[model samples]
Each structure stands twice: as C-alpha cells, then as structure tokens.
Target: MLDIFLMGLLMAQYTYTGYDASAHVAEETKNASTAAPKGIVMSVVISIIGGWILLYSITAAIQDGSEAGLTTLNATATGLPPAQVFLDALNNPTMAKFLLFIVCGAQFFCGMASVTANSRMSYAFSRDDAIPGSKHWKKVNPRTGTPTNSIWLCIVLSSILTVPALFNETAYLAVTSVAVIGLYIAYVAPVLLRRLKGDKFKPGPWHLGRWSAVIGWIAVVWVIFICILFVLPPTLPITISTFNYSPIAVLAVLVLSIVLWYARGKKHFMQHLDKEQLATDEKKLLDEIDD
Candidate 1:
C-alpha cells in the first residue's frame, strides 16, 4: 500500500515538474519579482484543479473493474491507457481519436514551453560564462531579441537525449525520472540556502511571513522524499534492462558539476556582485537609457 502511494506521489511530482517556467523567463518579464512568483503559484493551483477533474473523469470512464480490465488497458493498441478508456467509454473510435489529437496538441505546446524555459536558463548561465562555449550561447539575436544560439543548443541536446528511447524502452522512464529529480533539486536548492541563512535572510516583495520556516521545511522534505522515490526500482528482481538508471545519471551530473566548479567555476562564478560592480552595472543601465 505504501509502495503504491509512493509511486502515485512520484507520478504527481513528474506531472508538476515544469511550473518553474515562470522563474526561467523572469529576466524578460516586467515586475518580475512579484509576477514570477504569482505565476508559479497560479500555475500549480491551476494544474491541481485541472488535473483533479481530468483524473476523476478518466477514473469514472473506466468501465471495467476487474484485473482483466487492467490487463486490457495496459495492453491496449494505442499504448495509452487513457485513449483506451476514451474508446471503451465513448464506444466511438473517431471521438477517441479526436480527443487524443487534442491531448497531443496540448503536449506539443508543453514541449515548446519547456524548450523556451530551458533556452532562457541556458542563456542566463552562459551570460555569466558559467557554461562551456559561453561566448557562442550568450549571443542574442538582434532581430528577435532572443538567445537563438542557446535555443538551438537546447533543441539539439533534447533530440540527442531522446535517441536512447528508440532502442531502450526503459530509457524513457529513466529519463523522466532524471528530469523530475533534477528539476526539483534545482527548485529546492535556494530554499535550502535561505533556510540556512536563517534570520539573516530578508523577506522579498512576496513571502510566507511567519509560516515561511514551516512551509519551507515541508517543501524541502517533500522534494527530498520524492527525489528518493524517483530513483528507486519500479519493479521486483531488477535486472540490467529493468534497472533504474536515474540515480546513476544524476550522480554523473553531480560529479561533472563538482568537477567543473572546482576546475573553473570556483574562480569565475560570482555568487554576488560587490557594491562597485553593482554601481558599474547601474551606471551602464543609466547610460543605455540616456542613449
């Protein structure tokens, strides 16, 4: 029962993965400090409400209650249980296909949004010279005012990463796990840092106030718990093919990040700008405005 609950929780976390898109695009947004946080909160709230309705409707649509029905849905021709449910519940293949098309369209837009967020983040990192080949990736297109180079880099890398799914079926699950775990860790790192800062941490334009510590700690714990769940084997008697590779992938990334940080980032990465640097930046902005 606990295992089932954990698996459901893991899937929920996966579904909730991309809510931080608001933060990624903050640089280009007006009144970003306030709007970005509101965007994040609203995105999660909307997802929860919409997801609950969708899940309830799908659950209600499942006509079969037996183990055989489960087997049928699992082995459906569409390879999607929801599509099978729609077909079975509606008794109309055309309607099911149309519904599936709508779902696919939504997913296409979701992928585009993910790419946009990733490119912006990559551009930001490159702008600080934190990534290799920063000079190229940091380039913004004059006409579009977008990071064209970083966008293509993200697209190419995403395509390359998906190639493994063609040969290895389990690769898709492992990749999704890596994405969820990687994203959540990135999301929580700053919260963890702020918690470490304790009373020294100043409140932002929007904050949790007195409930901040409690809510922040709960979030930290939940992220850690889900991250652990994502890396665990999904089935019994795990063999090479059945093994969860997410942990290995995540460890490799951590090792690579540590190596890179020590090699170059430690010296070059500025965690905070000094007063002189801030003044220079302010002056630069003022000069640009004047021009």
Candidate 2:
C-alpha cells in the first residue's frame, strides 16, 4: 500500500488543484492582494470539505463487501470494483448515468479552467522574458487583452502530453504524477528562497506576518517530501505496463531546460522587475540626499 496511499495523496491534490485560478485572474480582480489569497485559501478549504464528504458517501454506499463480489475475468479489481459499488449504491442505472454525466461535465469545466490558468501563467512568465520566444508568447491581444499565442501553446502542449494516454492505460496516472510533482516544486522553490532571505525579505499585503518563516519552511518541506514520494514506482515488481514514467518525464524536462538555458536563455532571458535593484536604488537615492 504505499501505492494506494500515494494515489490517495494524488487524489487529494487533484481535488485541490484549482486554487491558483484566482491568481491567474488577479489582474482582472479588484483588491487582488486581499482577494487572491482569500480565494486560494477558500478553494482549499472547500475542496477538503467537499472531498471528505464525497469520500464518506462513497464508503457508506459500499455497505456489503460480499454483495460487490470480485470478478476473476476482469483485470482491474481483485475485490469489489468501483463500478459495482456505484451501481449497487444507486440501485439504478439511470441514476448512475445521470451522476456520470454530471461528473463528466464537472471534469470538462475543470480542464477548461486549468487551461485558462496555465495559459495566463505562461503569458505572464513570457512577458518577463523568462520563456523562450517570449516576444511571440508575450503578446496580448489588444482587443481582448488575452495572450492568444500562449493559450494555443498550452492547448497544444496539453494535447501532446495526453497523446500517450490514448495508447497506454496507465499513462494518465504518469501524466498526473508528473504534473503534481512539477507543480509542487514550482510552489516550494519560491517559498524556500524566501525563507533563505530571512528578515530582509519584504512582505506583501497578504503575508503570514510573524508566522511567515514557520509556514514557509513547512510548505517547502512538505512539498519536497510529497514530490519524492510520488516519483517512486507506483506499484511493486515494476513492468513496462505498471512502471511510473513521471520521474523520467520530469528529468527529461529538467535536462531539456538546462540545455536550453545554457544555449540561449542565459543571454536572452530577463526579469522585468528586480526588487533587490529597487532597494539598492532607493538606498543610493537616500545617500545622495544626505551628501
């Protein structure tokens, strides 16, 4: 059960995936410093409550393990299967179909929202010249105020990434595993860097205040732990079919990124704003005034 436990963790993360949606739309949001952070927290809180409730109901519906007997012909379930659980719980195919439709719709919306968020993030990063071919991806449509190129790029990349899922049954798990690991690293890196900066770090309007260091360290540590846990083989006696490709995918991306950084990014990539530079300039101005 390490595999089972890690899968549960993955489910928990997937349940809370859209917390950054507000951040993506912060430019259009009013009082973003206050609102954006609130959005993130509420999203997580709601997801936890809702996910727990759903899990409870599903467990409750599995009243008799004997009634949901295992099928020797099937490869998926050695014991009671989820499809049997749903059917037995609902006691009606019509109700099950309706529930399935609702779930499908929700998944569709979630996918759309993710695309929106990723595209916006790509556009913002590109605008700061952090991404390759930033000039093209950074362009915002004058009429729509949207990054069309970045949006299309996100779509294309998502499609390319999911292509393996069409051929391999376990490919979707690997894709999601890679996404979760990469995202957690992205989330933790800034937090760890902020922790290293210590008291000299400036706080935004919405910060942890006195708890910043504690919370930052906790966040960084937890993310690193989970990232390692998820990258391990999802099942024992790893075969080509059961093997997790997430670590490979992540390593490939890192290698490609390092190569690109040395070849072109080192010279071309630029950060639009440097808080350290701003602080230094302010100090210089004060010294000039005193002199």
Candidate 3:
C-alpha cells in the first residue's frame, strides 16, 4: 500500500507541474490577478477529467479479446508501450496510425506551450536582471515584441540538460523526478518568503485573506515532503542503472546558481517590481495622488 501510494503521489506531482502556465503569461493577460488563477484551476480540472476518460478508453480497448490485444497487453512478455496496446487492440494499422498521430500532435502542442511558458517566465525574471545572463536573455525583439533570445536560451538549455537520457536506462525516472522536484521547490520558495514577511506581506488584488497562512503552510509542508521522497532511492541496492540522479542534478544547479549570484549576479540584479515603470498600478495610484 505504501509503495502504491508513493508512485501515485509521484505521478500527481508530474501532472501538476505546468499548471502555472497562466502565471507565466500574466503580463499579456487582462485582469491578470483573476484570470491567471482561474486559468491554472481550469487547466488542472480539464486535465484530470480528460485523462480519466482517456485511461478508461485505453483500458477498454485493451480488453477487446483479440489475440494481438492480449499479447500486447502482456506488458512483461511483449515489452510494448501503451500506444502499442492501442494498435494491437484495434488490429487495424491505418486507424491505429491515425489515432497515434493525433496523440503525438497533442503532445507536441503541449510541449510547445510549456516551452513558451518557461521562456516567458525566464524572460520576465531576466528583465529584472535576476538571471546570470540578464542583458542577453531580457532582449525583446522590436518587431515581434517577444523575448526571442530567451526562447532560444530555454530551448538550448533544455536540449543540453536532457542529453543524459541518451545514455541512461532509467533516464525518464531521473528526468521526471528532477522536473517534479525542481518545480515544487520553485513554487514553494515564494510561499516561504511570504510567510517570513508575516503581517508585512502586502495583499495582492486577489489575496487569500484568512486562509492564506493555512494554505501556505500546507503547501510548504507538502512540497518539502515530496522533495524528500523524490530524492531518496526508489528501490534498494542502487546501482548505476537503478540510481536516481535527480537530487544530484538539482543540487548541482542550485550550487551553480548560488556561485554565479555571489560572483556577479548580485551587482546587476534588480528586485522584482522595483523598477517603477513596471509597476502599473502603483504608477497609476501615485499619479492620482499627485493630481
């Protein structure tokens, strides 16, 4: 039961990673405080409902009683992926290919959206000189009004980071672990910082009110627990093939970031929203007060 729950929790963490997509696009959104949160919630709810339906359909398809379906569903013997099960169950090459193509297209778009969100977030952070190569990454194309450099930066960095998958047998586990753990840590950091600020924390346009502290604490605790669980070896007798490298990868990046910040980043880095021009509401309030 414990093992089953652990794996289930791991999957949940992976699925929830990109729900912050709306937050990344806040700059371009109208009524951002309201809209972004709704976007996040809607995205998650839709994913859950859609995923359950798809899972049911796949499971049903596999029980078609055909010889090929039974063989492919025998995962231990066939060594087939879930998509192969679909192909075998249908027993029609053309239809199976079409269905697989649709799935692949959806996945491609999902990945593209995620990359878009990530690059935008990176661009925003760098605009405040928070990243190591701020000047380069923060550049917005005059014609396109997009952070073209930051987009490529994300693409290049992601490509480089994923190179280990080519050589490692359990690479998917390591990669997914790193993603789940790192994003949760990122999600938790500001919550902890807000907690530290206590009463001095300013209420946003969409503040949580009385439940803020409770929710924040719960998030912090859960994230910490997840991080610890993910870092530990998934199975005993860890070897080169079985070992999880996610914790090591995360720590390496963390250390490198710290070293870079101390060496050069601190001097150029500006506090987020400290630049008056970027504070739209504050600027409006100040103008009204002056008038």
Best by TM-score: 1
Q: What do the candidate models score in CA lDDT, each in turn? A: 0.88, 0.79, 0.81
User: How do the residues 69-165 of candidate 1 rate in per-residue lDDT, one tens digit apiece?
Assistant: 8888889888889999999999999999999999999899989999999999999988887888888999999999999999999999999988898
Candidate 3: residue 183 Cα off by (Å): 0.5
Candidate 1 vs candidate 3: which has greater TM-score? 1
Q: Which stretches of candidate 2 lie over 4 Å from their true place?
A: 1-3, 66-83, 271-291
Give the Å shift of residue 168 in candidate 3: 2.4
lDDT per residue (tens digit) for residues 1-291 in model 3: 596578668877787778888989988898776788788778988989988898778767765456675555665343545666666678887887888889889878878887999999999879878887788999999999899999999999988877877776578788888989989998899999999899996655556689989989999999999999988887779988788888898999899999988977777677544566568767674554344
TM-score of 2: 0.85
Query: How many collisions between residues are there in candidate 1?
Result: 0
Q: In candidate 2, what are the lDDT values of residues 1-291, reduced to their tens digit?
A: 456776679867756677888988898898776788889878888888988898888777764645334332132342325555677778887886777778789889988999999999999878778778899999988989889999999999999999998888679889988888887887778789989998787665676688878888899888888888887777779999898888998999999999988887776665455889768877875554344
| Clash pairs (backbone) in predicted model 1 | none
Give the clashing pairs for model 2: none
228: Cα error in model 2, Å: 1.5
